[model samples]
Target: MTSLTRAEIGALGEQLAVEHLRTLGLVVLDRNWRCRYGELDVIAADDATRTAVFVEVKTRTSDRFGGVQQAVTPDKVRRLRRLAGLWLAGQDKGWAAVRIDVIGVRIGRQRTPEITHLQAVV
Candidate 1:
């Protein structure tokens, strides 16, 4: 089998995360939204709860670097919060709740990739 580049893996992970979110009924608002500070992997809305979800996707082939869960550090969460605020500020609509989420995608090991989503990381 051929190996995938880091960018390719990350893209696949984000796509999988989007699909997973859609299956859970969240409507995707934006993807790869970027600003000077940083980039937001996925932005989705939970219409039923009137909530906006900001997601950070981490893709990995193995757990050598402490796995995906350990990838989002406290500082990273702070940055994500700031980025989320920046994104929200540009919206004309309001949300009852806003949340930060982390989605971990692990591929190339099993027949199907594994996805782990942690919501409300704040």
Candidate 2:
């Protein structure tokens, strides 16, 4: 069997996350939106709450050291907060709510991607 390349793994994880969000009825607006300052993986709208969601996708092949969610530390949250704010500021209008989310993905041989949804990660 061929070991998965980093890009392939990332693509799989992102695809899964997007699919899951769509299944949950969120309207996907953007993917991999980046600027010179930072990156936002996925942007979606939760119509139920009339809110905007900015997602960060974290992928891991193994959890022996730490899980994917563990990688998001306080520093990461701070950066995400700043980036999200920057994104919001650049937009034409404002929403009632804004959220920062993290999607944890773990892929392994003979198994599908394991996912963890962390809402309001910042």
Provide the overall lDDT of each model, using Cα atoms, as 2-decimal numbers. Answer: 0.94, 0.85
Per-residue lDDT of model 1, residues 48-70, tens digit only: 99999999999989888877668
TM-scores of the models, in the given order?
A: 0.98, 0.91
Give the true-structure RMSD of model 2.
1.5
lDDT of 1: 0.94
lDDT tens per residue, model 2, 58-104: 87887775875687889888888888888888888568899998988
lDDT of 2 at 14: 90
The TM-score obtained by model 1 is: 0.98
Error of 1 at 63 (Å): 0.6
